[model samples]
Target: MATVDRVEIEQAQKLWQPQPGWLNTASYGLPPEPAWTAVQDALADWRVGRTSWEGWGEATERSRAAFANLVGVPVADVATGAVVSQLLAPVAAALPPGATVVAPEVEFTSNLFPWLVQAERGVRVRTVPLAKLVDAIDAGTDLVAFSLVQSADGAVAPYDEIVAAARAHGALVAVDATQACGWLPFDAARADVVVVGAYKWLMAPRGTAFAYLAPDLRDRLRPDAAGWYAGEDPHASYYGPPLRLAADARRFDISPAWFSWVGTAPALDLLAEIGVPAVHEHNVALANRFLAGLGRPPGDSAIVAVEVPGARERLERAGVRAAVRAGRVRASFHVYSTSDDVDLALNALTG
Candidate 1:
């Protein structure tokens, strides 16, 4: 649990050059210089046919290992994919007939739809208020799924309580870390399945995602989207034959989008170097500063939902970038965000 010092945070901050008014990281992140450069280099190679596909594929492994390290999991337990829903598909498919899942009522559709779609097979999904999520898990609950941080409002889940409840009920735990990963320090290994769509918080390209499947959970899931990429040896697995897949979570991998991985590798590597605890401290401080300016109490989350009248249009007019979610102005802070960014948003809304 090494924490990064100010020097390290300053060094990491130099890697990105986000515009001063940028506050919409919850929607998408601006890539760090290394990641942007890596993607550009890979795209150049693709344009000229200067390198073989094998070279591009190497980035996928790099990204997978980096994501595993970021989440405190072994690489063997990690699976790579292009989106959160795609990665969760097999987990959803693994549900037993008549199984029940408990989730937050406002969960992003990517996590909710997969389980809800199982209704035709007798699997039931129960959605409750975020505050009631832990208490709602019962003996009949087969699994509990939720996001580490809510996308619309930046509410952090009660991770320990939910996990304890799930364990008490002999229920499996699944978490989507899309909005929390790089800025929130938590043990992803505590969950049976952890999925991340890296584009938003990890500052990577949109096509990059990762999942960690605990060994027992991995055993239960079928690699429904397994392709040559999921093979024990991808190059050798091309063309039909007696099926051979990796013995680990890689068996769930989908064929990666090459340029996306090229960018993802460097971005994740940078985040790992800076340490999530450092990022969390920096981001939450900025968020609190903004909240204070707006005459609101400090919050634990880096994303703030400002409900002031005409907030979104004010931010837009002031050249501040933020999202409108659930009728509030959603402004998120990340490692690249500065106090200036927060001030800009505050001025827009308070002026």
Candidate 2:
């Protein structure tokens, strides 16, 4: 297991001052001061036309580089977009007719819908329990797509096992890391494609998303959503004609939502500096504390699903923000969460 410095965690914690009862990072992360300030500044600039859009656009590259660093991939392999489905569109479009996709039955729609929509093209999407996901990938499977951490139950995927299985069967691996990327340390390069929504664990504005495309996968897909942003030189491509796209994964890029990227760049940079190992250590510790308080077995994930009666009402009454998913109250801990936040949710449930 990787170890992180307590000092680093402490310094990272100082970047955010979320309210005492924010346990809903699984739904959306509360941005740190820098991210919020960046967004605010960008909005102000937009309102007055005080600065050139070029300055705002620069943030997209910073965000792309930061996300690449966080996922342990080359910057050239990363592409920016507005959402997971948008990022995954090219991958979905690349599937051949009669191809089979295996995914969890309860997967969040962003990861599942794109594949399912391909039914008209003879693209078959097979749904199974998440625990059976690896076993479901076989000779017939063309692709295996799943979330790194389940949104409803907070179950961590068995990543290595799935990757090995996909490799053995020659199936492409597409991962949605929206719920896990910021705090979960894993190599995005292991998969054919990895898409992430920056709003949840990455603590960025909702419109920003990213994808990592392996060299082979990048070559396989068409840049279906290409625009000026996907060009070899965006400013030069503004007028038209030759259609010179980027030679790398940037060819798949969607024009970024500028203010969102401005907010995202600092958030991702902060997470990269703090390191996922440290964030994971802090977040999981708090999650385990909450689980223990509920008299439940400790879990390795930073998100916990509480099934006790009135869990949602109790947390709401106590001003502890959380979400009810699949009939259970989901509470997620992150870099800013502490023992006090866990205790507050515990008291709300048990008191």
Candidate 3:
């Protein structure tokens, strides 16, 4: 049994400014007051110089530890970054030359392009229909990259089964959790790699992301373009022989957007406080309300898509904010959303 504290959730909402009919957290999440305050505190520390240097380093590691806890992984396994694309490019480069990569055609481009671009290195990126994805992986498959939750229609991938299949074939698994992480819970233990951009459902500022690499997989990867920060001695004053890489996922790390890391640490801390299981419960309850209002069934993820004519104009005229994609009105829900937000979006579509 699991539970979310009502009083705590309401109290948490106070940290966020009220926004009417904003149901697009799947696009970009709004950071709460604490995150902004964290930025100010971080700025103040930097202005003070030497005395605050250790604090800056602590904040960065705090963010890594926070994200690790969020995804149920060890802190050493996680590495922060600027965005999903940048975090994933190295994972793509790590694959053996001429390996075959399988993915969904309708996935978010960040997850798709990195692998597709690998073709230039003799790696083949094959776009498989979702229905055929599990069956597509074989002995020759080097890696299977896909989203835990689809962004457009909010389709949740059957990853456990897929992971089992990929493992059976000795192929690696990498999951893009940008649309899934904070809102839904999954087992990252089964994955070789998990990547997420903090700006989306995690509710952190943009220019922040993290990747989790299983310890064994870390040895297999060769970061195509690592910087000085990616080294074991990131702050080392002098370079020497045997240019050292980090022992864990930090080998894939980059110079994080410092301010973004400041905000992200607090955002992740908030989620950890609320508990992901609780957030998932709240989001699913809101999704149910939105779906019932629209006469649709319980959806796979917090996102519910409906077909409506002139959908964009109607939603705008009614002051409802949602994404119109591929001729479907995609409404996404988060902890901050309420029943009224769902009703308002539904009324605009039905009215």
Model 2 CA deviation exceeding 4 Å by range? 1-4
Ranking by lDDT: 1, 2, 3
TM-score of each: 0.97, 0.97, 0.93
- Model 3 residue runs over 4 Å out of place are 1-4, 43-54, 237-242
Quote the positional error of residue 103 for candidate 3 in Å. 0.7
| Residue 288 lDDT in candidate 2 | 91
Per-residue CA lDDT of model 3 for 1-351, tens digit only, reads 433365567677788874789989889998878897988888887787635455555667888998888888998889878888888887788887899999988889999888888887899988887778999999988899999998887888999889988999999999999999998998887898899998988888888888998989888678766777778878771366577877778878887677788788888898898888777877888888888777778765788778888889989998988999766888888878878888888888888
Q: How accurate is candidate 3 locally (lDDT)?
A: 0.84
Off by over 4 Å in 1: 1-4
Each prediction's whole-model lDDT (CA): 0.91, 0.91, 0.84
Q: C-alpha displacement of 313 in model 3, angstroms?
A: 1.2
Worst lDDT run of 10 residues, candidate 1, spans 1-10
